[model samples]
Target: MDPSQFSSQPPEAYKSSGKSGMPAAPPPAYQHNPAGYPPSFLNQPVPQGPYTQGPYPGQPAVTVQPAVFVTAAPLANPVPDYLAYSIFTMLCCCLPLGIAALIYSIFTRDANNSGQRELAEKNSKTARTLNHVALGIGLVVIVVIIISQIVIRTAR
Candidate 1:
């Protein structure tokens, strides 16, 4: 195959890259300094492109975006405020409050394992149950006392 096929022009007209305004090689002689001077040629500034100045009119500068660090752990959400309040209310009272709390506890227990919800529900239920029992017993004792008083009064 003819080598002439490789280029647009004839081989006889070939010129060294230097003749075409391209770099030939490094300037041959380096001035050696007894003090061990750093080379000057490498320090020369490379030709800069127009874009290197800064961000373009509408475009952002070419920046390396910070990688978002994601974790295997799931994201957390805040517990609803009303649920927290209800559970608190149940604890302070003694009677029927306990019954209501028990209902809430059972209903929410599974749903609340978000840890916060479960704990609040559990406490509220406990309070309600305590109050409900206390109220029930207290009412019975009062009724018995009233009936005895009426009987004594009638005998007199």
Candidate 2:
């Protein structure tokens, strides 16, 4: 006969009311919006921050047609400094060649900023090609000299 097991309604079918000798609060009444929208939309999301609903300060913005912005993107090209220096350094073996490389890079950088990427790319490629040709010529001359020396020694 434990006191904890004693109950009038077997405890399973009983519900605890919050009120102690007083009436409990009823559910909130649904209020109709004056805009004639549904009551469920009372907590619907609204646009936040200046990006969606506001523009720059002090200026009233007019929304233009998005289709009007269908312009092609301007091409871009830049002569990297390291590439130029490496080419000149290999050929000239002089520090002053670095100055020439810097000048070319600067001119190309300007051209690139001005939207003349094709011209910049053409010049950059030409410079590299010229350097390769110069290198090939140098190698050929060295080989020819070595072969002539070997022939002369064999005849002696």
Candidate 3:
């Protein structure tokens, strides 16, 4: 490709103006300071001595209150005692209900780990209820066995 195709006008048209077709404006009035501080800071009056309670000679004395920041309470996670009950029921009570309780207890942990607090709470309640059911069934069975033994002995 020919480089001359990029230019629509002669080189004399580019001499007076920039790429925008207008002459560039002068820079701002502020001078760049090489010492890192602003140019205005160079002319400012320095402090006479150590800062006291009173104001400067021409300035008004202004009182400022110290800031007080209060942080919010931390989030507390819920603790569900489902696993312990499930384990106890599994050992000493009905096997099927105890297994269901154990499963729900595991689900509670999983929901808690996944940050589903509501689901975790629901699972925890279910596990506890199953544990109670297993315990009730175990107790009823024990009572029936005891009553049957009493009846057999009385009949003899």
Candidate 4:
């Protein structure tokens, strides 16, 4: 291609592609007075009647009372469930009593959670008693077995 074919200015197709080179006409002057326009709702006066104030005539006056909310207070000293003691007795001490203790312990926890303070205390006491009995029985059995083994060895 000859260097003379490419002019410094853009091609005719590019120059005519966009908006016309003429400046836009100035926007119509804003009419401050809305003279020819219809009346707006803002210009109209608000309606007044008996319905605006309170209850209709002859009916009792309605009083609005503030809402009241009541929540229960948390217990100061919660009862002990004795769950660990019950489990230990069940596993190592006596099976039947230990199982009973575990059940009572679970009952105690459930009662406490359900907001039954009296029931929780009762179940807690029962579990503790059962654990004590189970542990006592286990200790007595162990002692008796050891004594018997000692006697057998001496006899031999």
Candidate 5:
């Protein structure tokens, strides 16, 4: 069979002529309507402008407002959290005082994040004080242990 003839023939004709041996049904006919679409959709006018009137009749027209943005100014002298100092004291100095310091440092950070300036400052000061006391006590304890070891060795 010629390829050109095959391309021109309908699919049903090809199938019927093959092993089935059945007659090919007639191809469907195209019926064009004078009116392309329903009158309701085609006759409706498109809305214009940024703001359109409400869907129901006699409703007020909707108005669009521009977006607004607000930003806070950077602080001149921000309170310190002293997190690293608290952590260091907690790990290397005294356990109880260091833990307290660490807690205050966390509080300071939380207050700072919440925009509570006075609370942040207070927490920061407390953390600093706790760290200092813990470090001082650690140093004194270390000195006392060293002196006792030296005296014990000498006595032996």
Candidate 6:
């Protein structure tokens, strides 16, 4: 005696087949994008009114600074050549000490030019010492010669 038990069609089909003589409500609006974007954004329409600032503008500004390097100046080292003094010692003073002074003077200049600062300084000091020794020996020899000359003149 049940109508659905006797019918072959499903209950849902019978409900929508218009057999009851009443129209069904229109189907819900078709949503093209299921992501939830508004219909106006999906359709072609220029946006109206001022908009709020975005999370970031143009991927945010990037600032990069260059590296700087600093270095201190080298120490000041001056080495002098005693060639003039050596020459004066050789010509007017002791011959042996003057020769040693001259050799040291040449060594000082060569070492300085070759970037051997310590060696150049040592050689310059040696040259000055030799010059002083030569001057002292020369003064003693001069005094002795003068005394001998005075004694000879007094005897004559």
TM-score of each: 0.29, 0.34, 0.50, 0.53, 0.52, 0.50
In terms of lDDT, the best-performing candidate is 4
As a whole number from 0 to 100, the lDDT of residue 138 in candidate 1 is 59
Candidate 1 lDDT over 26-58, as tens digits, reads 456755533323233555433344334544346
Q: Which stretches of candidate 2 lie over 4 Å from their true place?
A: 1-115
In terms of TM-score, the best-performing candidate is 4
Task: Estimate, for each residue in 38-118, the C-alpha lDDT of model 2 and write its tens digit.
Answer: 334445544444345544446798887766554433344455424555456555543444445545555556556666777
Clashing pairs for predicted structure model 6, backbone only: none
lDDT of 3 at 143: 94
Per-residue CA lDDT of model 3 for 1-156, tens digit only, reads 889767844466645665676775555566554453323344554444343245545789899999998653322585484898898899898999999999999998877766677788889899999999999999999899999999999999
- After the best TM-score superposition of candidate 3, give how far the Cα of residue 48 lies from its true spot, in angstroms: 57
Cα-lDDT of candidate 2: 0.55
Give the TM-score comparing model 4 with the true structure, all chains together: 0.53
Model-by-model lDDT, in order?
0.51, 0.55, 0.77, 0.81, 0.79, 0.79
Q: Write the per-residue lDDT of candidate 6 for residues 1-156, one digit (tens) a residue.
A: 876586744557645565766775555665564343334443444334445232232477666699987643332565887999999999999998999999999998888777778888899999999999999999999999999999999999
The true-versus-predicted C-alpha distance at residue 8 of model 6, in Å, is 99
Q: How many clashing pairs per prediction, in order?
A: 6, 0, 0, 0, 0, 0
Ranked by lDDT from best down, the candidates are 4, 5, 6, 3, 2, 1
Model 2, C-alpha of 119: deviation from truth (Å)? 2.0
Query: Sort by TM-score, best first: what order?
Result: 4, 5, 6, 3, 2, 1
Positional deviation of residue 28's Cα in model 6 after best superposition, in angstroms: 88
Give the distance in Å from residue 9's predicted Cα in candidate 5 to where it truly belongs: 57
